[model samples]
Target: MPITRRSAMTLPSLLAAPALAQPTRPIRMLMGFPPGGPTDFVGRLTANGLQDQIGQTIVFENRPGANSVLAAEAVARAAADGHTLLFASNSLAMNASAYARLPYDPTTSFAPIAMVATSPNVLWCGTSQPWHSLDQLVAAAKAQPGTLGYASTGNGGNGHFGGETLRQALGIDISHIPYRGTAPALLDVIAGRVPLMMQTMVGAIGPYRENQLRPLVVFGPNRAPELPDVPTLKELGHEVPDSGVWFGVLAPAGTPPPFVMRVSHALQAMLEKPESRAQLASQASVPAYLGPDDFAARIRTDVTNWADVARRAGIRPE
Candidate 1:
């Protein structure tokens, strides 16, 4: 059966697993992005905060490759011990359609632990662009249907989906320009080589402040607190679901539920801290905690939604 929004995962089944001894050594969490990016920074910060609640050292290992597929595969093949976990992002779901095949089944290969935080994507353009707002840019694209292109960190990413969502909404044709990573894609947008792009609030903050980019609209359900001046797509009645980037935890499919619960509780506890909330603010994110059951449901929804986007956009890996 296909993994629908209803059947993607079940927390109760994982909870039925036999409880196992917790690891005495440090826990190792793996992420797929290179160091010095927003994902790495958010992952490390959350890990540090959660470390206190768990009373165990959590070591991070970067396995940067194929938009985190390399590290995700590593965790899926690791022992089902709770000590080895995957700190994945929204790409976990997007990769389902982004790539033709992945070593691990995103829906079945991992136990959804917790969804920690999420931030909106800021639709931005270069300072040199003539349009000052999303409507204006949409008009420009309408005038020259296939000429406008939007840059994104990679194919089958939030940018790809978000950009495609806008295209579908307006009935326009805009090309997707995929770069190896955010840095290069963003650099091109700044140089006006690409007229537009969607970046997470965390990654867009610095450049937006320096006036290297102009944020026209936020693609989240609500306006980002960090960019209150920029209106959200919802505010304009675009009727699209939130396509923001999310950070979450995952474990091997058979990992003991009690251990997963422990980490999930620790993460929920971290959100209660003012310092943790403030720290997340610096990352241009806000805590949106969801325990195992809810997190599984969220993954189900995103998997279903992004897959639709991939189908509509005809996304295929190179």
Candidate 2:
């Protein structure tokens, strides 16, 4: 027998439907970076919070390569049933301008859930280096242009562009030495092979605390709470402001609107927890809660902002 329209329009039956039908299944969160990086660390923390809040297991899958393009593609191609999500970061948005072509469109290949957190990047030098502050470092770089080399995760990474932006902004010349990852680059800096590098406050915190690295200036409007003594680039006489890194959640494009909203609400609840807030603060990250539309707007703004930075720095990635 054909179902009647009056029966299908019953509000009680529709209202009884589960918001997340697969509530018991393990949710897969994909990370573009490797295990020990900030992205992985924060992703795991977020998963833990969500697991406790949503009463489901959240698993993290690491697919590290090609500047996180592999993971982004995997998430973009995954089933849009809300079980699979991407722990997207600045790399995804920056790649839009860094790479000439990508397997997926960053802006449209995924549904924005909520921005997890944001942290400033710090310009740090090896402890053994003579320069102690931004002013001193710029003075030395100006005296010997191209002699002071810095290391970054890659040519088109945030650290790379941040370094280049500083060079252009301060009218100094410094050679950039790109590495496969921040770990190796940080090692090089510690060994004095590379004079300096810009890294996330989270990543630099341990090294700085251990006395292996000396922070020069953070690339943000205000100093990082974890490193309150460190001055911002703008505070050091540079006009650069609000240069930081962020992490967010994304589902594959075409994901059901109901599922996306469910996931977003779950994440918002998790972020509101006191434990989650403490975890974020411990990593020097500020929690940023934005709904789908607002998060999408942020992505667009970031793409436009970083595209200009890349263009000005003459960064054309292959």
Candidate 3:
């Protein structure tokens, strides 16, 4: 039997019971990015918290390749005994559309446990550019279409998706300059090689604070606390899609409901702690806790949304 939202919501109470079965084997939390990245930081944070609650060692495994497709597929095909888990991010959702055929279904390959946190992407411009606000940037782009270029981590990544969505919504022409990763792309933006970029706050905050990059807007419901003065895309009068990056935990599809509930319960408790939230803040993320059902729904929505964006933008697998 699969765990439902109703039963999973009682995980905290369930954990209060003295006689709970703990995992005999070590738990593995696998992610796509290498260590030192934001995803890795959040994964380890959650894993540590889980280890404390579950009374078992949790190992973090990084399998960096193809924007987490490799890690996600590995977990999808792993034993569904709840010992192996995936620390999923928006890359999984974007890959659903970006790739022509994935080894596993992004929506169905794994069972969602809970969403750990979300970090909004920031639309930034180089100080060399004169556009101070998103409105000014749009106006400039409209005046000289395709002259303004934005850099992203790569084709079909969240940064790419954010830039594409903004292009379509505002009906402007801006050239996309995809780089190997966010670091190189951000460096170019700061060096004035690229005029703008829609990058994650975690990756861009340091440069922005150092006066190297200027943030115009963020892609979320509200402004980022780090950039409280900046506005969101919606506030700028644009119906841009919410393309922020979110991190979540998932187990193999056939994992037993009780086992799934146990992990989810542990995560829910950990997220409620102040220290956990502080740790997330250090990673430039905020707790966006969603139970299994809601997390599943979010994945389904993202898969659909990104697929549509890719189809309309004519983005294809590499």
Q: Tell me, by TM-score, which candidate is best.
A: 3
TM-score of each: 0.91, 0.89, 0.94
Better of 2 and 3 by TM-score: 3
Ranking of predictions according to lDDT: 3, 1, 2
Clashing pairs in 3: none
Please write out the lDDT profile of model 3 over residues 1-318, one tens digit for every residue.
233587666766656533333556898899999888778888889899988877779999999999899999899999887689999888988998888889999888899988878899988988888988888988898889889899999888989999889889889999889999878988889999899998888777678778999988899787898888888888878877788899999988988777776777788778878899898887678888887889999999988988888889988877
Question: What would the per-residue lDDT of candidate 2 be over residues 73-157, giving only the tens digit for each residue?
Answer: 9999988777888998888888988889999988899999878788898888999999988889989998998799888888788
Residue 75 shift from truth in candidate 2, angstroms: 1.2
Whole-model lDDT, candidate 1? 0.84
Q: Mind sharing the TM-score for model 1?
A: 0.91
Off by over 4 Å in 2: 1-24
Residue-level lDDT of model 1, residues 1-318, one tens digit each, is: 122343224423332334463566899999999999999988998889878766678999999999899999999999998779999998898888888889998888999988889989878999999988888998898899899999988788888889888888778889988888888888999999999997888888778878899989999788999777889888888877567899999999998777887677667767778898898898788888887888888888888988887777777655
RMSD, candidate 3, Å: 3.2
Off by over 4 Å in 1: 1-21
Q: Residue 59 of model 3: what lDDT?
A: 93
Error of 2 at 8 (Å): 30
